[model samples]
Target chain A: MASEVKFEKVDFYYGAFKAIDSLQLTILARKVSAFIGPSGCGKSTVLRMVNRTNELVAERTRLEGRVLIADENIYDGVDLFSLRKKVGMVFQRPNPFPKTVYENIAWAPRIHGVKRTDELDEIVEKSLKRAALWDQVKNKLKSSALSLSGGQQQRLCIARSIAVNPEVLLMDEPTSALDPRATARIEDLVEELKADYTIVIVTHSMQQAARISDSTAFFLSEGAGRPGRLIEFGETERVFTNPSSRLTEKYITGRFG
Target chain B: MTRARVFDLSAKAVAWAVAISTMVFLILIIGYVVIRGVPSIASVGLEFFTTAPRGIKMQGGVYPMIVSSIYLTVLSLVIAFPIGLGAAIYLAEYAGRGRFVELIRFSADLLSGVPSIVFGLFGLAFFVYFLKMGYSVLAGALTVFLMVLPTLVRTSEQAIKAVPRSYREASLALGASKWQTIRRVVLPSAAPGILTGVILAMGRAFGETAAVLFTAGSVPQTPASPLDGGRTLTVHLFYLATQGQIEDSFRVAAVLLFVVLGFNLTAGWMMARFRRRFG
Candidate 1:
């Protein structure tokens, strides 16, 4: 597998305090890579670093080091508009605009310069079908996106992102707000989606990382008032069953975070 | 009865009594005006609504005054809405958490608290004389726009602040620019709220007496231009009362009351509809 995203000697800080300290990792394309850790472990920080979603932290934040996507540094005066369009994101909560389902699906395409009516309709259909939501929502495309259930809204959000045909999809706790049934459905969807796009997920559930991800990176904060750093990274089977580091072994065996 | 139960009942009784008395006072004022107005209105017939005022003769009706009131209210809104809403968006979204923003907010609050009579004096000095609008509808509209601007800014800022933060984040993450996010998401979600502020400002502008008395002259004619001097209902009623024309004052007061009541009803219905759809 080729490396699609590489974080080289990255140090992320929020104001005067550091959040991510000296992290290094290479995520491969067309694979599900899970970053699993306890709360405040900077796993979510790592996930946000990819698409620069952390830019809205509303505090004085600074990043040192390179976050390269396909061997290109994403932070060095990159065209953020096109970069964001190419790398879509699904938030923890399903926040659809105060618009109809069809508008929600069509909005991304329209803004990204798709102006033809027939082309937009076709993209909306294909995107929704890929997100596994076309059948359930086809009849009610005119309904408000907010009217759907939580799970359906999340899927719609996914479809909305994929409408832009992004090269990567970033999900931040995509199932934490969902019930088990919805969670299971999303897990299945991820398994199928990994065939075409690079999927990066931030999850606190160890079982979740074990079940779906092909590669896993374990992270931990050393102690009080310390920034989190990566502890281990390898194929999922070895990371869970035969971690080389004592810290990764103890965490996987439920010793402590 | 237990002491606690007795005290609760008495408290409820006091609250109900206070509320009912306020309602009664309102009703008495409206009722007195309507009753006193009937004799003069019946004597005048449809001429009250159709004919222009006869000025000092006071024999015709107040049609010109009604037209002036409508024009003044609409013009003030046209001048104030865009500027006030823009200021509000800046305060809510772009303003820094610093002493500068604090200074702006403090100024807006202080402006709202200044008396309408003070606004009248300023209008008399600045708009009527200095700007050379010369006691015209434009002068009155510009003065009232300044007078009600603080209300629009404060209320619109509150409405914009009420939108959820998640909406902003979601829009930005979708590759939409900051302006696009605000235009599509923030403003739409804040529309009903800002509209409430607008309606409240309109009510205040429509009934304003002192500001218009100073700036919007007492000319009783059908104004053909914004530059032409005009007389609003409140000014007409004030003139009649001061001149001891009790019956004419009563009729004008009744008309003003009904117009205000109509505005309140529309505002209530609009707010209820907004709640039903967006809640």
Candidate 2:
């Protein structure tokens, strides 16, 4: 089943440099929400916050406020291992494990206590098919995933995420490293996957946001040294066509980042 | 030629000269050891590895010393590997840019820089006398354990750190626990580096004379227990050479050098094979 993620007045900092400040956003259940911003605008930081990935940052960094999934505050006494299982993430680059294609998808299931070989095989096949990668990798499931093409590897990463049966899939510019052909394939896959999982993606590509996302949140840097802030959030079609803020307009029309 | 071309050619010449000189120095050292040690090898034949050391004027083999050296090296590695590797994992995976990490790193560096003789003195005082263990294999093993710990920690940390962050992120994104990510992805990639550190530590332990001399004592016999006295090949060689038994000293030196060389070569081959398997 799908789950809702809510971020309330969340602020992140690396020492004195605040990364995200007083941010509030509610991601709809089973919908694709795209966060579009220029580089270093804290888009990726926000994406990582949902899964508590920022905990991996050194202790010198600080996080405030609450990130909730399914009405539970994830940052409070929550087991990070279980939280990560429910809310999966994908990076900007295609980083499949240095394992076989089948093993890559089966790793999480195995670690989470799925020991039956037939059951794991079924999960791997189904997840790969869901990611639209099963056909291409079916014959070479035993080969190293690093041997896959960039697009194939990204899909493989997606399949790996889905095999864990995560309710929320957070992708940080997942298609930014892919070619147009691969990007289109991922775009199509995202649309199909939104029916079963809540998807949040951070992207620099406005066209990609317009093409695939259900809702769009535009963020912009406040000043030279200041961290980025949310400028606008609404339906993708309305945000792109009739943006309420000038900065959002400028960004959509390619005037300024 | 242009000025830039002239400068480039001069830089290339200097680089080549430095590289060749380094290689030549290594070759010279190795050649000298082989040439000076060959006569003793011919005299002792295979008995050097198969017989026990006898008194100064008599002819005998250094088999007891060889066995002692192997035992000490293996025991030290067994002790050092877990502690060193655990320290490395803590530094590389858990500890971040904080005062504690800096403190750990600084202490490891300081330990590495301390002379081997100081470790010997400390081992003699603490393990041999103060602790009242006496000159025994246990004391020598403990001395070597302290001697190689910093090297293993630093090298293993470097190897673990060298693994691409992308690998960790990928594994984490796939619903793996932090420990699982480290155990499955980071450790395997870092294994070759950790292994290299272990091999280097083994080499140091095998050839160590100063530390073992004070703590283990030069008892030319097989150790019946860790508490019993023993002498490694390097210590035996030093005793023979200093005692003016030229022929016996040469023979022991040759055997020790050959053993060290064989170990180094085996480690090198294992490293190469590991790279081929994992690369």
Candidate 3:
């Protein structure tokens, strides 16, 4: 079910203020790719483009290139529901709905036309198990999703996205707000999930990118108000050890953002 | 004491006095009304509520007026709730920051600020005269609906806007369509706040007199249909007080106070239940 996501020389603007400049990158199917950069580096923007979620935040946005998933141009004539169904997202914060844990997982499937109670139950259980939240919340499915701890809530969010049986998962700093143990658990979950789903993660921590990702794409905005550009993209091990660009090496070695 | 300390103490005394005076004024008004009305209510017994007015509306119950008030409130709500909620959702979620939306919002604000008497005049000219609905419950309800719509729309818009943006993002990313996200997540979260606005509008509709007076006639008979002319409790209260039936008017006032209080309490209880379920 996994699908590769490709950004072909994309230029994005938030109402005339350029955000991403001439960015070209391909995220392989069934692999974990990490985007590591500073706060305003547009890594999150690039990730959002894969599912067209950036349109929700800024109304006057303008895009200058194609975002393709599984060889289909998502920006041209694709249905947002189908596009988002194929490529799910987990936000930086754990944003579970103000509903029961069971409802949170069942919601997407229900919207997607899965109505039978037994089928919804099976999907909910399988999703929670996959997200590693089944054990703790198995007896409390009826409880509000907001009652869970932060990490648990994030995992529930992951469960909710996967319940729709998506192919690609876009995670925007999914673990930035989590504690070390919760972050490690998510890292472990990501490692396991990569066997089936294509995952793109944006992270601020260099160590986190080094720890779990198969490939690394480093992004940087050279100066203030300048559009962010992709500086380097390669195998994680090679990029960290022997980068081609001096700027990439400097950023990897903690010289500057 | 230091000068600063003295200043602080004086400020505290003044603030406390102002707060206490406000509380005292509220209690005094309620207490005086209840005391004045209770004797009249007690003398009338249950018949005061069950029987229609008779003998020039001096001896019989205010039953028809009570029924008319309820009918007006319910009909106005039925007519206005959907339109107001739809407008609110559009203004908050779909509409862009354009001139049309701005004009709509400004018109709503301006309408809400207009006096109820003005609304009564409009109702008389439009629904009563032009529409030819006559001085009936339908005309009164249409007037009340227009008067209440602006307030309802503004409050519901604020409530919908206040829902956390993250919830919308989460729903959209999970493959739900925009309408689906709004129905399942956004509206539910905003339900309690919207209910507050509804209840406030209900109270206003129930207690309204000036607007209903011109639209709904001062007929004492029970309205058999929305097209039948009737008088609400507030309009009936006005008729009684103006025509030297002071005791009957007091009884009507007491009933109005209690019914409005009942609506508020019920709404508060429902809001608490909704919060507990959602949170």
Top of the candidates by lDDT? 3
Query: Which stretches of model 3 miss by more than 4 angstroms?
Result: A15-17
Q: What is the TM-score of each candidate against the true structure?
A: 0.93, 0.88, 0.95
DockQ of each: 0.57, 0.47, 0.79
Q: What tens digits encode model 1's per-residue C-alpha lDDT throughout B1-279?
A: 999999999999999999999999989988899899977788899999989877465767888999999999999999999999999999999998899999999999999999998998899999889988898999999989998999999999999999988878877778888888898889988988899899889999999999898998998876788998899999999989999988889999988988888888888888787665444
Classified by CAPRI criteria, candidate 1 counts as medium
Instruction: Judging by lDDT, tell me the better candidate of 2 and 3.
Output: 3
Q: What does the lDDT read for residue B223 in candidate 3? A: 91
Best-matching candidate per TM-score: 3
lDDT of 2 by residue, A182-232 (tens): 999999999999999999999888888999999999888886668778889
Assess the local accuracy of residue A147 in candidate 2 as a C-alpha lDDT between 0 and 100. Answer: 79
Q: Higher-TM-score candidate among 1 and 3?
A: 3
Task: Write model 3 residue lDDT over B63-181, tens digit each, in one string.
Answer: 89899999999999999999999999999999989999999999999999999999999999999999999999999999999999999999999999999999999998877888998
Worst 10 residues of 2 chain B by lDDT: B53-62
Q: What is the TM-score of chain A in candidate 1?
A: 0.96
